[model samples]
Target: MIFLLGLALLRGRVGDREAWHCGAVLIHPRYVLTAGHCVRDPNIPNLSLLGVRLGELNLTTNPDCQLGLCSSVVDVGVEQILVHPEYNRACLACHDLALVRLSRAIENLLPQIYPICLPLDPEGELGGSTDALHNSRDWGWIAGWGSVSGDPFNAQLPTVLQKAQVPLTPTPFCDALQQRYPDPSSTLCAGGEGPFTCKGDSGGPLMIDNRMRTRWYVLGITSKGPRVCGAPNTQTLFTNVHHHLSWILSNLRP
Candidate 1:
């Protein structure tokens, strides 16, 4: 489920066509892992990315996608947008992460479209202290279309493609949420009290399921929470993708 696409120039109106403001992860076939404020928001002055929508699960009609009854969909057109060069729009989780790059190349692969495995650590260790994600299993999974009733002005978004199962908020409660949101030591705090992850589930993915569960290790990306999304102990913040995996394998281009 990928879908970034853009054209949110705002105020100066670039024709406003944002097919899915954020959420991505297709690690290659033309790369697409998102969230650097979904490719630079800086409080939104110009915005404007445009590209990414592989095997979508229904963003309200597409190739007749009655919510994952989907048969075909693959938008791809962004030819580049690599945010994290120490991204810091005043630290919502600095170095939020981004890497889109697709103008072509997604030759029909499915199981709801593929690509999502980038957490390796056989000693060439990088961030998040990987050892296949250390004491693994703090629980995961977090798909998105975002809001399901965390109403930031009536955001009832859902047409299928919204998963959740968070749990992983203990590093002294993410060090007390990095003392009120400083998060960037590679972030990584999950949520509680039933599902969480709102405002368009930022950069999507936070998977993890491999203990013979047959692979699925994405481990973080959705970055930021507590604007009342499932707010009961609140914890969201992601973006650890194994601590940038060497800045996402040196900006993946192949």
Candidate 2:
């Protein structure tokens, strides 16, 4: 597990227990992007949402440090959580994203606990267009501190953050999964054979570097996948951010 920046861990209290609920990305100083289900899923109940913890590399230690350097884990309160209106848990398809507005601004934090860049119109083509997404080479970076093993509660959670580079799988790959996987236009599939995300990795970012590798862009948000992650011929599903750019732009507020 390597140190991945711009990743935020959504923490909350569940009936006297503090838990890392889901993953999120810092897009703006005062706004974080996550999955709709993360904010409102009846299956995951009784979670008294607290805030987000940023600039973290390890979860087992306080003030995670390495090579004689340490990070000040910033915990900011959540001012509001806006789940996409079109999101429906029953369908488990499109519109499975959310936006979180922080109680205060995080402009001061940069180059450390900073925010990642959103996709922009490149080469006159719309951002997230089918052409642009495929023009780039395969694979995107996925990082998180989620469970390293089986069922979230029953599995072993990683002490250090985990990172993986998974190739952008095709629509057929997802369709063959035989699950109620959403349409490729709104969702994407990756890591079908092996090295897929496990439970507790939802709402996390699927990132890709710019042409010059100067900046990271959130390509997708971890949504759903097989219960037995890493199973043969199984893949993880992600909500394509490019497909929801309009909704995201209109909802972002400081």
Which candidate should be chosen as best, given TM-score against the real structure?
2
Q: Can you give the TM-score per candidate against the true fold? A: 0.32, 0.87
lDDT of 1 by residue, 1-254 (tens): 22222111101122474546677778777787877887677677677776666666655666534444444567767777888887775555576888877888774555446676777752332224543343545666777777789767888878667676777645454566666535445776777668888887788777765555555667778877777787666677777877678888987866
Each model's lDDT comes to 0.66, 0.76
TM-score between candidate 1 and the true structure: 0.32
- Please write out the lDDT profile of model 2 over residues 125-178, one tens digit for every residue: 324453356545577788887777755447777878888987775656577642
**Where does model 1 exceed 4 Å of error?**
1-22, 25-33, 36-51, 58-64, 67-71, 75-78, 87-93, 99-160, 163-175, 180-191, 197-202, 205-221, 224-234, 238-254
